[model samples]
Target: MSNQTEYAYKYIRERILDGTFKPTQKLIESQLSEMISVSRNTVKKALLKLERENLVSIENNKGATIKSFTLEEVKNYLEIREALEGIIARSAAQHIKDTEIDELEQLLLRMEHCMKQNQIDEYSKLNRLFHNILYNASRNIQATEMVSMIKTQLMRFHFRTLLIPGRNESSLNEHKMIFASLKNHDAAMAELAIKQHISNVRKTIENNYQYLL
Candidate 1:
């Protein structure tokens, strides 16, 4: 992609993931072009790319709007995510190196600090980094690719969920358990921990976020 298109894509995608762009908000090419200092055509290309990623809906006369999901669709995606995370956790337990364990430990400490400071946004970013490290440590490229794709689809929803009251602390506790299981090289424990963690997240979303559902 050209620099202009790349900049437009990143700027718009970031806003969507961070909730700055509300669901169903219109994407006006002229407005975005002015905001990002890119041409309207470049903004159009960025919208097309986001549409391909399932993040935007383009109508014949209505232009583009941020995509929203039904409750059932979110649930189905969560189920697939849970399954992929379970496999990744198990593989990480078997294949992770001592250095990777050390890195995870450090990340957990930072996350704990975030919890103490009530920094949900910072904690959410670190939480994603932790999971990315764990998945990559597994060294299963195909599995990694699949999980990454699903994660991209759910990133916005995941960010919204993390902002829920008390969810940051709860999610940090779950990550601690997952890290402990990985440190012990206990494959079954790691797998079960991840499965339970994701299951809890699903329950949390269903119970508290009726608007999202």
Candidate 2:
């Protein structure tokens, strides 16, 4: 894609992922093109790419809207996350280098600082980075992509997870456990830790977002 198309794509995608666009919100090409200072054609191309990734839907009459997940779809995302994240943690534990472990520790320390400062948005970004780094360390291309796609879909609800009372503390502790297991190269322990972490988050969403479900 050209630079303008790429820019439009990224700008719209970021809005949807961050919940600025909102699920089921109509995306007007003229508005997006004007907002991004690109041609409508470029915006159209960007929306097409997003549709292919299941981030948006376009119809002849409806134009485009951010994709909305049903309760069942949300459940499937978490279930898939649980299964794939376990394998990712195991692979990371087996293959993570000493330097990589050090990097992860640095990330944890920063995340702890975010928690102390009550920086929910910053903490959320670091939380994402921590997991992405772990998956990258696993060196499994297909698994990483699968996890990334599900995560992209789940981003809309992620802020809700972080905002829940006491969830930050619990999530931080869970990360510590996963980090410790990875550092020790304990594959089984790492897999179990990651699975439990995903499961906990799933339960939190189920309890709090009954309306969505």
Candidate 3:
């Protein structure tokens, strides 16, 4: 992609993942072009890309907005991840090597230190790295690509819940268990760990059931 498109994608993706642009918000081409310091065409390309990913929607009447997710959709997302990630972890265990194990260890250590020090930025980076290691090990490029996109969408909620009390610590411990299961090459245990991890995310907000309505 050209520099302009790259900038456009990065800007829009950040806003979408950070909840800076909420659902049903207009994505006025001219205003976005000005705000992102990109051309209107570039902004259009970015918006179209998001639309293809179901992260944005445009209509002739109401125009564009961030996609508002229903609770059913949220449940479906987790269910898919739970199923796919379990298989991914199982498949990954067969292919994971010593070098990959070392990389995972490094990521786990970073996560542990980041949690202890309360370094959200570093923690988040290591968090991504930890999962990337498993994704790569899954050895399914198509699934890897799709999972990355879904992961980005889930991150909006993940980061939000991180700000809630006790979430960070809980997240750290869950990851530690996942790392341990993977380290021992126990795919079934890893699968369960993945489910539990996602379940913890689902339980974060007491009133989140309202989102379904």
What are the candidates' C-alpha RMSDs? 1.6, 1.5, 2.5
Clashing pairs in 3: none
lDDT of 3 by residue, 1-213 (tens): 788887898888788887788766778999998998889899888887888888889787665788877766776776777677777777777678889889988888888888789888778878888888988888667766766777766667766666666888999899888878888888888888887887777666334544422
| Ranking of all predicted structures according to TM-score, beginning with the best and ending with the worst | 2, 1, 3
- What tens digits encode model 2's per-residue C-alpha lDDT throughout 78-182? 999999999989999999989889988999999999999999999998998889779878967788899888988888888778888899999999999999999
Q: Which residue ranges in model 3 land beyond 4 Å of their true spot?
A: 205-213
Q: Is 2 or 3 the stronger prediction by lDDT?
A: 2
Candidate 1's displacement at residue 68, Å, is: 0.4
Clashes of each: 0, 0, 0
* Top candidate by TM-score: 2
Model 3 — TM-score against the truth? 0.89
* TM per candidate: 0.93, 0.95, 0.89
lDDT of 1 by residue, 123-202 (tens): 88899889988987896778778878777777777867776777777888899999999999999999999999999888
Instruction: Assess each prediction's global lDDT (C-alpha) against the native.
Output: 0.87, 0.90, 0.78
Residue 145 accuracy (lDDT) in model 2? 91
lDDT of residue 10 for candidate 2: 96
